[model samples]
Target: MTDFLRRKLIQAAGSAAALGPFAIGSVSAQQKGDIVIAASQPITGIFAFAGTAMNNGLNDFVLWKNANGGVAGRKLRYVSEDSGFKLDQGVAIFKKLMASEKPSFFYGDSTQWAKAVAQDAVAAGTIMTSSTSLASSMADPTGMPQHFVPGPIYGSMHEILMEYIAKTWSKSDKPKIAYVYADTEFGRDGIPAGKARAEKLGLPIVTEIVTKQAGIDVAPEVAKLRRARPDIVIFQGYILAPMPEFVRQMREAGLQSQVMGTAWGLDKPAYDALGAMGESLAGVSPYRYGHETDSTMINAMRDFGAKNRPDMKNISPFYISSWLSGMVFAEVADRCIKANKPLTLPNMKAALESMKEWDSGGIFGTLVDLSKHQAPVGRIYRYEPKTKTMEPASSWLKV
Candidate 1:
């Protein structure tokens, strides 16, 4: 890390440590004492990288908002639980948060957990959104009402990747595609979507590679993809697993296949691992690191990093995503507070459902069109290791 980046990370860590356990003033003292948002993440196990990023973003946003006088003049409180990437533990933690505090909102770590929380959130009438981009099923038009996905669903990203390849590699015959995916539901979810789109584009999936979360070796898989000579290798795995290894090995083996990643597996850890070797590894992401478009929000993020998390240089898409979540929650709560609605789960859901083309200010450009309960669209970013940066590969895609 550069000297500037190192100093920034230290600041981020200090800011994170200063954020204590969440609490609020007496409900009787104020109609809206504190806005409690419950976050359940896998901070200990396989998805530690993403979980850490999500939590750090959540805490950082809360601190940033608090420093600015908080959301709608109400302080934000959060109960973040570590689920250890276990499904059973996830359910237990969700129950604890619901039973103890009855939080106004739920923020989930991964797609599976997002689905697990959907029914209860709806039954309780609490508005919820996820950092997970894979739960298109939960965000399905016909399925859940109180749930929102702020990023591109994996299925949509896969479609975009295929189109990019088709338009970019128009002349290649037998454009072989390789698949390297984790065995978990979140990782495997991208495969069918990718395959269906690949078939439509007439591209052949020549090599299929699956690895256990416990075992993340991609050398064998990379060798297979190399042998197949695929024009592109699509990676779908945990952030902590085979992705970085795959990228490094693919480069070591002299494989020229372009690397495309599904949503969950895309982040800074992937880039930091492969370094310059990760240049050709492109993935669909919700936010671009070097975005020149929203300077105001970008600057706010920079200030936050400089003040609190200097170590977390090159902010991940999850940072913007979590920041947006906090911003949206605050805005909706503010609307309810202004309308004299009670500050409770039901009231919050009412406010969120009534939310139209809500702008997240400079935090997010996508309109929070509640008709879809999803971000208007998401952007794709490609990592350019040569510059140690990530740049937009396309405009916001609405698929």
Candidate 2:
């Protein structure tokens, strides 16, 4: 990593009161408090693009909240360490925080880490967690009571994309569609359900291509897409690579398919990297972006970024997800405290379940209903490369 990036990460691990946890990586936090919100963040590795932003976003929110008199007058402490996006390291960090920090709420790195640690978390019943992964399985409040997905499940994101496509079909024939995804769990987990939704909408899925998440060779994939000539090509589980190359090659092959993606593959940076290729790129997002004034949370985020992180022009969607996680944590904690309950597993779990039609300060344009443990909502956005902004393409979808 560049020296500047390294420094920023160390700062993200900044401590709150006393020296932070040392066994994990450098730990940065916000405020000094008893209600600990610890995290096993993916600060380095293939996912750093999103993970680092997550660290900053959560830490920043904690700082912001502490400035606003904290929950129930109890201070909130935010502690976190970089797990380098590794499952083993993330699990270790989780264990360390649960043991040493004795936190009331936690943020984990991925769907894998959340599933791996759920049994332990539920057994402890003293803490609750939110993760970057939006796996549908984690949304089951009955099965994974201790873990909650921060946004829409992987399948619901796909289903929302299908809804957008179905509504926008101006062609004489039903739009022929192609689904391209990586071979990872995040990639393939949602395809079956998404395909089912598309079938229900009577949209013809012409092809499904599975490939590596990031690699140099996409010619073979593009060759298949070329042959299919579907009107829509939707991507999932990819961060940056392959999508740009695939789009470039498809255009070179003289095809005119509309390219779209789920949340992961369509971050602002991905589009910024794509430059002109992203001009035609439209994707679904669970949270509102920073370019608009419609959302109270989005506006606050924009002002906060300008003042605190001036170098970062566009706040990341992953960061918004992290901030949303912090919101949920604080909300649960506040509810528990107000109810004169301890921050135990059952109490906090009950507090979380009680959330219905909660206003997220406009983070979500619509009132959030997390009764199912995942927010199955999204809005379609088209990239405006000239302005480096994500402009809305469709209304908010609560699927």
Candidate 3:
């Protein structure tokens, strides 16, 4: 954090000590210092908006964490490469960084990168990894033991939405749900699991719509959806391009079906681009929005952006996701250091898993548990265009 932000925080909290557990501490360095957190971030390409924000969030967190006592007396040092959101490029960056930096924690760009580097990370044995992905497959402790998700898996997100639909449906017949996703790995990842969850709840999957990454016509897709007339439609594997058009066209077709999305889709840009129709979009979110007051951590994030990134608007969900990853990294390293254990993969993995009812100081409204490699709590939120915020539509749910 900048000096101005630190001074402002202290003043806001009344005293240095009044800032509580997350308050800044003496900048004195320990003998064994500089815990490295490296990343192959997608700062370019399709996910640039999210990637740029995520990188900024992590960088700011490192600064803030160092100012706040440096995690067991060791200051954080962050290094990153812009992977351009390409899998091969990301993997190569991971290799180069691992060899050069020997970081204790590494954040990946995508599920492909996470999977590509998992075995190598395990072989390194000195690092644990995390990413923006909530792919259910990444949650396996045995298969991807050294990797952890910052939130619930995508399947769990779909199930959470289904649960909400089931509980709120007032008709005699079960509500019809449709899954509209892209053909990318991320787009197809959760469909099977989501279908299973819906079947388990006795709800019907009326239709499943698939789209390509680009150059696809939505008229046919909308016509197909109009025919299905699903009571609810859940979108996956996209940031913005087609969703706003789909929502608009669907509305024009005189369909009143509610639209929903998962984590990445809930970012501010996606909602803001939807204009007046944004209010109709609702979905599951694992992290608190930066503007929300309940989380001290979130408030601090906003303060950092305000003092540092003056031109930046509201903090995006991707920013919170990466910020949470930094926190998790620090917590794991802190645990290992306090116990006099080496910051090896096994040690960090154990430290990560042992965190039951872990308080992220406010990122999560509910206490977090990473034992399953996933923080299985999420809340339903609908965008309120009037306020330009995603207001909570339901209480927190753990699946």
Candidate 4:
């Protein structure tokens, strides 16, 4: 770790120690061979399908880790609550877990909840990860220092996509682009940075369309996009519903612009909803798909699913991402123990930041980097209807 990061960890540890009983009490009384990990997940509402799969994947990883002797011989005790995809509910669940469970680590549901409980996590000296990969704000070491993810943030994904677009542009004229995102923090988190990057690439953002997560009428949005006539439309902040509706509506309105999505916007659930329309879609993703059998981790996930959830047919990208999140926490915790450091909040943070080119067992295409607290690498993939898969359009690019 650099001097700057070391100082930040020391300060965080000092703050926690100074907070007296509350901070001290935040550490759960683990029995021999026990480490508690808690999460607030979106098991209902708009993100229900994706959230439930994420929960299952996380739970399965914990089970698999325990079966495999866990991290440094300490069995993980994973606990999670349903957030219902509501910010207030997520915060409430987080507080409940912090107060009652006193877990050493927490996995939050969204960018909003991560931001909401950041101070609490820091004050209590708890390490926290999130379900969302690319919330750029959470990657600020000085701001939400305890926040970390297993994949790149939204901004990095957008930057990679923009670079790809710049290279792929065949015309001498600058490519016209438009951003169509949900009107939520998750949807709009990366737009400003993305817009700045686009400007730098000489791609004019012709239109910006913000609609509700559950947009009932997308004709107007499609009409605006049609008028702009962008060469490409990048989507953010949506998992399945409005995005598919918008794409279908765009097609209906005779808009032939190539559609792309952020990580959240490009997943099995989204493709299932998009059907044939998904063929024209492409996006940046931090984790390999569940169908990528070549991955050892993915193969393990498949075996676990076959034995545990035989009724379930497919493991989505969201599930893989969630599983990777759990694995990352376990990896960091194990490293702390191997270094003879107690699995305290400060120690966990240090272990995470100390990681440099650490292999993720193929959870990600590139080695993990926790200094930025973001994955910072991914591949752009285009959906292939014939194979019914998102085939890689480019190699893993670190941003």
Q: Mark the 10 consecutive residues where model 1 has the least summed lDDT.
A: 20-29
> In model 2, what is the error at residue 209, expressed in angstroms?
0.7
Best by lDDT: 3
TM-scores of all models? 0.78, 0.89, 0.89, 0.89
For residues 38-152, write the lDDT of model 3, one tens digit per residue.
9999999988887998899899999999988999987999999999999999999999988787688899888889889876776655678999888888888777778899888
Instruction: Indicate the TM-score of model 3.
Output: 0.89
> Is 3 or 4 the stronger prediction by lDDT?
3
**For model 2, which pairs clash?**
13-27, 13-28, 14-28, 14-29, 125-345
Candidate 1 vs candidate 4, TM-score winner: 4
Give residue 6's lDDT in candidate 4 (0 to 100). Answer: 56
Q: Write the per-residue lDDT of candidate 4 for residues 1-399, one digit (tens) a residue.
A: 345545656776876456533333334353235677898888989778878988898899999999998888888989999999899999999889878876777887777888888766766655655655467877876666777866888888888888888878865887789998878778888788788888888889999998887735888888899899888888888877777777777778887788888786777777656656554678888878778876788999999999999977888877887888888788887886676655566767777788877787786877768777787888888888888777788888877
- List ranges where model 4 is wrong by over 4 Å: 1-12, 15-32
- RMSD, candidate 3, Å: 10.2
Candidate 4 — what's its lDDT? 0.78
Residue 263 in candidate 2, Cα distance off native in Å: 0.7
